[model samples]
Target: MRKIFTTIVAGLLFAVPFTAMAQVNILACEPEWAALAEEIGGPKISAFSATHARQDPHHIRARPSLIAKARRADLIICSGAGLEVGWLPILLQKSGPQVQPNALGHVTASHYVPLLDTGAGVDRSMGDVHPEGNPHIHLNPHHILPIAAQITDRLAQLDSANADYYQNRYQDFAQRWQQALAQWEAKAAPLKGTQVVVHHKSFSYLIDWLQLRAIASLEPKPGIPPTSSHLESLLQQLKATPAKLILRTPYEPEAASLWLSSKTNIPALVLPYTIGGVAEAGDLFALYDATLALLLENANVE
Candidate 1:
């Protein structure tokens, strides 16, 4: 009887820690947030991105699998500010209380970061401009620390038992991230004031950070595809005032940027806009490293 009682007590003791160590399932609206969550949450969290490096976050189908993942997620991290306005609300509705907007488990990075291009009154005629402002805040290295801090706070809240662990990890990540930001700023010095064209406004944050001059975009407007007339106009414009290079993310169709590049004799640079955006961009640190390297390489920097 004594031996059986001891065995039961030991089993309970082991089970308690195991249950406590169960990983938090986090559903991130974009790849950047997912990567940041991993940096802060470490092994205590399982981060999943709704969009990949190859997919445009501006538009995504709310597939059943996504709905299912939301349903099971213990927490939600998203850019908000209308970036995922199309489908995230639907996902949240299906996800139930676990990851609701106001719930403790839900954290939107945009709420914690300063936004640009705001108050541009909503007008369908203006193309896909977000009335709330530009949602690509992650590309700005300066904005990342605040977002990471928010993620850490939420993680600590959800798993209070592991609060110290998450905090410690955040401190280490913050230190490394600050170091990387300084290095990136110094390395990107050459790119300052370099003129470029883009497929969309996606690079606004990076452009803003590096002080790169974005002279024009392939799109007629925010989300509208470029019409032949618009492309012709751009070609004419470039003749008078040429840009250094044409820029686009890996997910953006190359034909337009390539067409412009060939006609103008300018290089079309496809940058890794996020973690997993390109082969070399496997994480946050790699994302910035690859971006600066690509921009520098295109500018003929050794």
Candidate 2:
């Protein structure tokens, strides 16, 4: 009996270190960052997105499931810049010190990228404006590498034993990503100045990256939903200026864009806003591929 107990204790002791080194648990605020984490961390990390592509990150609730995930997370990756101001703080409160803000495990993608639509005074009247600039930074393929590097560095720092492994993975991803960037830029050359209307600023980075001209938004303000009056005004505006495409994310309601499209004969396109937003956008690379495809397909619509 004594010998069996001792063997069991030894076995449990051995399992502890193996479990500790199993994988770094990452909790990402959105699907895009979660996909980026998977690209950089590979098999060494376990990543879960708190918000899926079909949901708006700005309006998530800090539910118990997310809190539970946060508590176990070794790292937290978020867009930041107050994008998740509504729910992230609640998750952070329930999370451990390791994943808290300013900690090694905390990575904010906005910190590493050049922000757009900044320096504007924010107020409720302006709708859901982020004073820290736009948080939807992932659409710009140019911004991915820096964020990927930051993720790699954070992963290496958290799991030092796999530092070399992470570095090699990052180098490979960087190479493939750079190649894709070239291809995307070349393919998107024709869309450089294509005029379009948007439902929201969700695709600001994407529009900027593709050099597409955004004539107006369906939403009168940043986070405000489109009203009948606003849509009528947009109908009048588009009839005069005449944008070729009406763009919206999968999560946004289709009513406004479709209404305007019906009136103006503009093609309303639903670009996948993130991974899983559309079936074709199953991963990071696929997300951009699908977005560009949709944009190009509708770019010349009469």
Candidate 3:
């Protein structure tokens, strides 16, 4: 009888860890995807990012360690649209069979997103323009919702056994996210129709959502940096029209933003374009909150 009791307890100890260790292994190439994967994955997945909030998602270093992690990932998510054209290819080439997914096993989140440009009147002279529209669509919460849904679907595909649990979490998150969107819009309604200057064309979706007018861009053209001629022209335009605020990303050069702001007397509002870009932007919800906060703070009312 004692032997039977001892064996039963031993069995229970062995079974507990396996049940606890059932999390999925996922390696996201960017912070935004990583955040979504974690949210949709719930406690069933482990997601890691190759870059930080302060880093540019467009240019990342391909480290061997990262390749090893990629090799182990069941799914690899990227921003796509040639945004990671600079580095993701190298990681793809270096990732060994450990990470290689059969056509059925591999997933590219970009294919899940709607491409804007798709080589429409694309040219190199456009600075570093993505012939695919903008790869930075994650800047918009509406765009992010679909991506989150996609992540949830892939997780279900990879771990169908716990698919329902993942699905439930996704539905809950989406509902909450939608509610947050409504609230944010309500709070920011006052800023609608306000004119602002953006350093990059990255915020068209957000700008459109908020109904703000973009008076000028710091870049003379796509991929081109701010030049003396462009700055002079922008300052003149701002002076003529009087933009209320300057929306700039943290990854962008503050010098040009400062110069433009100082010249035009419009305060430059530095905002995080992605998750973890700032402490307040540590998560997806806070990200939108921070963005709205900045826009609302700077908006001009007549």
Candidate 4:
């Protein structure tokens, strides 16, 4: 019995270092990054998102709990390009230098992906335009692979002991993601050049990827709320071109899209903009699946 107890204690002591190094705490700014971290980090990491799918990423406040999460995080992953400009700076300021910008522990998805709608000479009058570019890069499925790769590198850098484990999981995720992309592309083939009116420029990357034409935005400018006069102008403009649907993310107010739909005779569609944006968008894979399915359903392309 003494030898048996000694052997068990020895095994546990040997496992201590590995066990301590296994769990990495990742703080993602949004649900998409949280989902991607789960895909790459697998069981080796614990991921937490600051914002949910149904929340507006732009206007979120830096709560105390988020500050606590940032302080304890092994790495911080965010969309960057000024998407979280409102609150991330406050969180970083409070969390200290561990997850500051340009640090290895701080990873921004925008740094990995090629951004669109850049150099538009944006100003404060433009209403929340990202000077770095459209920060909604996650809407593009093509950007996911590079972001995932960058995240994997960061994971390995912060937790070198689990480097091989992270890489293996990333490779597997990459394979499955590529396969899923092919399926999404095939499914969304009919949506190419489909004209749509959007609430914001948030879906720019998705529209670009699917070859959808964005005729008008309900919000006259990015992040600006739709006004009666602006909607009137948009309605007049869209009538000439005839957009098939008026689209908005789950977080966006439905009134404007619904009003536009009623005025224009176009259906208003709420896209599952990210993980958990809709009941069907429970994860990254389901996110795209639900988005494309909704687009096809509304496009009337049977």
Residue 261 shift from truth in candidate 4, angstroms: 0.5
lDDT of each: 0.89, 0.89, 0.76, 0.89
Candidate 3 lDDT over 243-276, as tens digits, reads 8888877787788889888877888998887787
lDDT of 1 by residue, 1-302 (tens): 99999999999887664425489999999999999999998878999999999998888999999999999998899998888988898888877775888788899889998998786466656676566788989999999999888888888878877888999999999999999999999999988999999999899999999999999999987788888899999999999998998999978889899999999998999899998878999999999999999899897643
lDDT by residue for model 2 over 1-302, one digit each (tens)? Answer: 99999999999887654324579999999999999999988988999999998898889889999999999999999999889998999998977788998899999999999999886577655676566788888999999999999999998878877888899999999999999999999899999888989998989999998888999999988888999999988888887898889999888889999988899889899999999988999999999899988887878832
- Residue by residue across 56-102, what tens digits does model 4's lDDT show? 99889899999889998889999999899889998898776768988
Compute each candidate's TM-score over C-alphas.
Answer: 0.93, 0.92, 0.87, 0.93
**Candidate 4: lDDT of 290?**
92
- Local distance difference test, candidate 3: 0.76
Supply candidate 4's per-residue lDDT for 29: 96
Alpha-carbon RMSD, each predicted model = 2.3, 3.1, 3.5, 2.1
